[model samples]
Target: MSEIRFDLVTGKMVIIAVERAKRPHDFAIAHQEKKGSKDCPFCPRNENMTPPSLVEIKDGQGKWLVRGFTNKFAALNTEVKEIDVPSLYRGEYGYGVAEVIVESPYHDVTFGNLTLEQMKRVFHAIIERYRSIVKDEKIKYVQVFKNFGPRGGASLEHGHWQVIAIPFIPELVNREVEGTQEYIKKERKCPYCEIIEYEREAGVRLIGENEKFVAIAPYASQYPYESWIIPKEHQEKFEEIDEDSLSKFVEILKPLIEKYEKEFEMPPYNIVLHTLPPRDIRNYHWHIEIAPRLTIAAGFELGTGVHINPVSPELAASILKLQNL
Candidate 1:
């Protein structure tokens, strides 16, 4: 029974990796496939099922290549009345925007099958939504994520991503911000930037890189084959990546995603984009984390917030590197 501990010491999120009882293969979970209607509402032609487009990238005929619209069953409704919080225990109405990004018109198209151009459009659409949401004075954070395959939390089979603009910073983001602040005060350096420089020098856990970005399996990977995509430069906001660097980012991202698909037989995965708080971009650095759904959280991990990854990041990097070979 191994126990891993993560603590904040002098503003750094220090992770103590310990030997766990389970082996790597112990993390694997049985996968189940979902059967559904071919006429899923998220499919291009069935756009009527969703709310009218907040924004759409259109073709010459005005048919959409990709579209953004509000989710009908939104978890946070923007129309709700706001409440004022008093003291340590604050209560506020859930007033936020939840929008869906429909990736393509093709009913059966998956992200893995999308062309580079298509993927670029998806990335652009996400940026566009983020920019629009941040303009709302009430909104504080914009979260963009994809739930691929059934296991990763996608209720629909159609290739789509979700964006939620919340009135408050999420707890995870709050923790990260506090952690970064502490690290800066203690070491006069950004923890993420330091990790980036260290990873680049060591090269053992690196998966891929281009002029502007690098993808690496972190020194303490929480899951087998987990990887993070970070800007080589310390930029706090994803929107700040200029058009040239954005193109480079797209170039680097596609091949790595393809590599993951090939290596794990198109394993189910969750992709999360973490950025600085809307107003605090100067102090934070943005990154993307891709965690493959290769393992399930058993009792030990769930109860203790510790992960037991069988494959070390060095091995995962090697496997990812082989895709080019």
Candidate 2:
């Protein structure tokens, strides 16, 4: 059966077509693992391979558990002075920040295998880096994202996350801010908060929840088996999360990743943390989106701005909930 679902934040539509799952190559069988580790820049003993660390989390012996550094090949550089341009047509100097956070000292260890303590360190390191980057008034938004496996857009196989600071708000984030404001104006309530309550009450799309966080398969998922983890209380920025909430966030996230590992054999996936701009905190809710690269978007999706999800959020949530950690 096929059904259409609309994204509340972006107003984009997606078609849920279960029958399409029968098509060949609809889902991936296994997550590709990196073969060579000796020459990996992120591996231990390769400190000289990358730029000096901005911040490093260490053990008692001072060995790094997590490290953040400037990307060697930065897409944007703070060193570049801002260019002066006219209003009619504008272009700026590549003035921004690019950083890479190595999640583990070991080459092969990933988020799926990280212990609670290690995960905490990683999260804290991310918060530290983000806070540091946003201190510069020129940096408006900091995007924290992870790419795992080849299909997930990782040229190197080491487990790492990237934080890129841009001078302006992204288009998608702007859409979300505008859409949330519109929804609040019409409904007199936060749309995401309402969604949390509705999904919790419905239970069909709800995966699970902890004291502070909830995991759910969103109604209009853009990708197969796509899932989201959000705080129960409305929050506009990830940096505002307290220690307790951070712990609870990781508690829920762990099992969600385990479910993906078990069901899809540790498939390639991306974790994107969506937050309001550091200065702009109104009419938005922060969330973590896990999009598995199980299927590729072809011409139809690119041409029409529509997605074809082969699995329904209800069924996907049920499957994820049933899996044992």
Candidate 3:
């Protein structure tokens, strides 16, 4: 078989074709152990153990359906008022916002279990938090993510997501923005939008699609079974997503999560939301990446940036599509 290669062009949508594919049985799934009897602070009954709510969604009767609070073991604490740094390598500072979003009162309710209405509320709450945090002049970026199961970095058995607003742009984000800008300047079009249009037309790596969004296993997926959810419209900032589009986003997203859970047997995964910097909207495009924890990072993967995945995305998409998920 010939080796697969990807060549990203300036104005054209590129879809690399893979010549070889692996069967599902060839891949191994990691099973996680359930949490033991240690008291989980995220449990609804133990909500008092956590920091006071920053924001919450209330039921018609005024009961909390979902809640957001400052993380107890935060990477950045607000109380540390003054940070003194004399050297570049060594620095002391508390300059970010870390908050936990408790998804549901029920411990078993994962993202897949969320109803469409509940998921819409969750997205709304996330936008509200992002808008609030960006108003602070110190914050440069806000990252929203969820770690599901132990493999994906979930410490607690209870399902929850986290949002971190940082004072500086992360190196990864900087590189992505620069790459995007370079591509846009040369092509006069968004790289992501080009990919979306190409994926829809190729119809090979497509996992799912709806009126306003399309989920696809990227041609250059870094991990096996990796997928991305992109909005049909070119929206730079997630917080700026209008109500109509937000509803459409939820409509497509909920089923994708359910498909992963049922067909992939609830594989552990990480979900990341990438958007534009609060003040800038020139090059960035908002999207969600769902990376399933299907493989461990070995020395080669760490030493070199390239990843080796045994399962080709076209085959994975075909398998996922056939499953009655």
Candidate 4:
């Protein structure tokens, strides 16, 4: 069976082709220990290999469990204090803040395998670092993301999250923000909040929920096993999320990632945190989007901007929820 689904925020269309599930192993990666081998710079005792730490989590003996520092080969250089390019060319200096948060001291640990306390510490470091960067009025948007495995565009094998603060909001983020505002203007409520309610009532696409967050496979999911973790209450900014809320969010997230790894045989994936842009909290809601790189995009998808998802979000959620993780 096949059907069309539209993303609530962007209204982008996707074709869910259920027949593709027959080739489940097509998305699996071969076992590769080299991806998490030793001698990595992000590992413990190699702190000097990268830049100095902006934030670090330590124990009673002062050994670090997690650390955050400026990215060595940053995409946007922090040297430029402000935009300096000529207006005639319609360009600006690559003025931004790029940072890396090493999530675990161990070389082999992934998000699915990390202890609960360790995960909480990593998030605390992220929240604290986020607070520090947004204070700088020059930065307009902060992008938080994680790239896992070779197919996920990770240069290093280490488990880490990258945080980049830019001078301008990205096109996709802008569209989503606008969409949310439009929805609010007409419906008098947050679109995501409405989605949470809708998914719960539908039940088939709702994987799990706790006191603070809900995990759902979006109606128009663009990738196989894609999941979105959204807060139950309306929260506009990631930095404003308290420790209790973050703790509950992680509780649901850890098991969800574990389920993905077990079901897909360690598939490559990316995690992106989308939140309200700096100083604009009312019009948008914060959420975490996880996209597994199970399929490649070709001409039709690129040309039309319509994704062909082989599995429906409902079926994906059913499989994940049935797992004993």
Candidate 5:
């Protein structure tokens, strides 16, 4: 039966249309990685193409594995300019930072190709960049995300992630904070904490888990095969996670993407890290949201801001758990 479910954490709603659902294989798309062109800036030996790295992780042989640098075509700039605007339009200087974290030196491989040790180093780069960027007092929010394929908003095929620090807190973020805080106040407990416990007990939506994290297709999932990799503990910050526990995160993430490649034919997807704003860490537990770009938002979705998911979270989790890996 089709029904509407509201997300207590994000305060969003989604319609699960059971009648329109199909087999998991039906959503497969061949998202083959393209060969790296010599002119590709992210390619190795092309260091001159981009500015010097802001942060870099190198192997024992001193070969750079991951590099973080200011985006050449940054949407936000660090330069602060005074602006006196007319009354009709109010704006401030585009004072923020945009950076790209090259996940791998090899351009042909997607993030899924990174070895277990390599994946940890890439995240080490990510957490370092995130911590350094968030320290800037001018920035209110820092976003860490990866666009996997062309359909997922990547102009470049190389596996990389972007970190953007903006001057003001975004509307959706503010809403997330406000809404989740209210849930905490009403329930007298952290909703995410209870969710982990609840879903663990339920097991219907649970996909996988490790010592420190749980991977699940959320009960209110808005997209097919969408999942959340959340810390088992009630952690407020992503970078604050201890080093020993990071392997647990990498363990769950690597296989899920492998499963996606095998089952979904490497469908384009976005990996979004949801954490608290720099200034406010109230009533929030950080998580990594995997939003697969299998379906497009059409008129109903765009018009109502409500997503229609053909497959239910139960089915999605079942299919994902079918993987022996």
Candidate 6:
């Protein structure tokens, strides 16, 4: 049997086709234990390999725990102040900031492998750069994202995350903003906050929770094992995360990734942070979305701008909860 679901944020349709999962699993990943890449620029003692640090965090021994540097192959740079579009056509110079956060000192340790303390340090480095980048008045939105393994779009094996600050709001984020605004107008409340409250009570789609955060498989999940960690309150900005909340955020995230490791066998996945832009958006709640690339986007999904998810989010949540972290 099949069912159709609509995502509130993206307004995209998804086909929940259970028959698609009738086949055997295809996500058996034989992960090789990686030793240090001697020439890897992100490794320790490779300071000379990359551009000087934009910012960094140091441990008690004064060794850099996490580092932030401008991307050598930056998609956008601050060099171009502005560009005027031709009257006949619409375009502008790539005028923005592209930076990378080297998540850890160890070349092989990923977010899942790092000590909880190191994960917090990585986030602090990310936040430092994100706060600095967003301060630019010309920048409209800043995106913080990570790519892990092959299918997730990682070119380098070393653990790292990237932040790209752009001149205008991107389409995906804009759609989300529109969705939140419409939900508020119609129901006089925040959609995400409502979702958190609903899921907390329902418990079927929930994976884990703590005092400040709850991890859940969104009701209209677009991918397999898709999970989201969100604040219990109505915090709209990731930059506003205090030390206590940051620790709580890390607490919930660690186990979800561990669950992925146990269930998917280290499958490639994307982690994206969706937060309010520099401009204000009322009633919007910032959260992190983990989209595992266990399935591909075929013709119907690509052409029609819809997704066909084989696993029901409810079943996925149940299976994920069975795996102990």
Q: Count clashing residue pairs per candidate.
A: 0, 0, 0, 0, 0, 0
Error of 4 at 57 (Å): 0.4
Against the hidden reference, what TM-scores do the models get?
Answer: 0.84, 0.86, 0.84, 0.86, 0.86, 0.86
RMSD of each: 8.9, 9.3, 10.9, 9.6, 9.7, 9.4
**Stretches of model 3 off by over 4 angstroms after superposition:** 1-38, 79-92, 322-325
Predicted structure 5: lDDT: 0.82
Better of 1 and 5 by lDDT: 5
Per-residue C-alpha lDDT of model 4 across residues 1-325, encoded as one tens digit per residue: 3333345566564434334445556434322324544557798877888889999899999999899999886767665534443443334456678899999888878889998889899889998888899998988889999989888877788899999887777778999999999999999999999999999899999999888888999999999889999999998887788878878888898999888888898888999999988887558899999999999978979889899999999998998773332
Candidate 2, residues 1-325, lDDT tens digits: the string is 3233345566454433334346456344323354678888888888899999899999999999999999886767566454444555434565678899999888877687888778888999999999989999888788999988788877678889999887777778888889999999999998899999999999999999887988999999999889999898988999989998888888888878877887899788999999999888577999999999999999999889799999999888988883331
Between prediction 2 and prediction 4, the one with superior TM-score is: 2
> In terms of TM-score, how similar is model 3 to the real structure?
0.84
Candidate 6 residue pairs in clash (backbone atoms < 3 Å): none
Which of the predicted structures, 4 or 6, would earn the higher lDDT when compared with the native? 4
- Misplaced by over 4 Å in model 1 are 1-37, 82-91, 322-325
Lowest lDDT block of 10, candidate 3: 10-19
Off by over 4 Å in 6: 1-36, 81-88, 322-325
Residue pairs with backbone overlap in model 4? none
Q: What overall lDDT, based on C-alpha atoms, would model 3 receive against the true structure?
A: 0.77
Clashing pairs in 3: none
Against the true structure, candidate 5 reaches a TM-score of 0.86
Q: What overall lDDT goes with each candidate model?
A: 0.79, 0.83, 0.77, 0.83, 0.82, 0.81
State the local distance difference test value for candidate 6: 0.81
lDDT tens digits by residue: candidate 6, 1-325: 3233345556454433334444344323323323458978888898888899999898889888899998876666566544553465434566778788998888877678777888898889888888888788889989999989877877678999999888777778888888999999999889999999999899899887888998889999999889999999889899999999999888888878877876788889999999988866555789999999999998998789789888888988887773332
TM-score of 6: 0.86
Once superposed on the true structure, which residue ranges of model 5 sit more than 4 Å away at CA?
1-35, 84-86, 322-325
